[model samples]
Target: MSGSLTAIALDAVLEEHGLTLQQLAALCAVDHDWVSRHIEEGLLTPSQHGGEWRFSSATLLRVRRIANIERQFEALPELAALVADMQEEIDDLRRRLRRAGLE
Candidate 1:
């Protein structure tokens, strides 16, 4: 229920992706607990309401990226999340730079 993941936007993304918790776990090759822990720790957010967890494409990408970072370097979850956050920021900046013809 935080960040820029508005329910309306998520609904639109969900309509396209239609991914469930299990699907996300399978795609990321991780388990349910991993995703749950990330959500509980505020590293990820679920839908604004619902007993089930519905994921968007962005969530899938983020989970895989964070999991890969943690496995590859044996990094802690917090560190991995931090790295993911920085990477997202860098990507956003790059997009802005490209739009401004400065990339």
Candidate 2:
């Protein structure tokens, strides 16, 4: 009984129907205003229909990354965005490396 704890990983299947602003806020553990601020800062993108906003799984992932950086490092929104940008670039490189059999 001396092994490290193991956690189950779920392959979350985001609803193809898309998520609303409130749903996104709940997932990100932030308030509506926080999400709005990110959107205003040009960090998060949303699609509007009939004056309501909707987000996709990719946006959810990006918001989670931005929120983590902001909370963990106390980074400003812009700084967190910069970090997210670099992280995305690293992710792209890793994907390329894997494609090239270098990873």
Candidate 3:
């Protein structure tokens, strides 16, 4: 074991999230390979160590946020502009809903 205390802390964080890589990938709307590669490259750190793979809820959350942004706003400049316009409209609707106490 790397360190008993460190392992214990990692386990605690995993317990709070209770997600597997597949689940996280689904939530992020990205391929499992991408997540795995990112982890292997040390771009993301796992919260817990499984037999072969480690998982970090915090890292997965960040990935999901990025994936959502990318999906909503495609990479192309034209698509990005359209997505931004749509997002602005959505934001306005959300604000109106909140003010109406229906959010």
lDDT of all predictions: 0.85, 0.83, 0.64
TM-score of 3: 0.44
Q: Arrange candidates, best TM-score first.
A: 1, 2, 3
List residue ranges in candidate 2 displaced over 4 A: 1-15
Comparing 1 with 3 on TM-score, the higher-scoring candidate is 1
Taking the tens digit of each residue's C-alpha lDDT, what string does model 2 give over 1-103? 2232221111133434467899999998999999999999898889875688988777887899999999999999999988988898999899999999999
Please give each candidate's TM-score: 0.79, 0.79, 0.44
RMSD values for the candidates in order, in angstroms, are: 7.1, 5.6, 11.4
Worst 10 residues of 1 by lDDT: 45-54
Candidate 2 TM-score versus the reference: 0.79
Off by over 4 Å in 3: 1-17, 69-103
Tens digits of per-residue lDDT for model 1 on 1-103? Answer: 6656686686687766568888889989999999999999999876642567778767777898899999999998989999998988998899999999997
Highest lDDT model number:
1
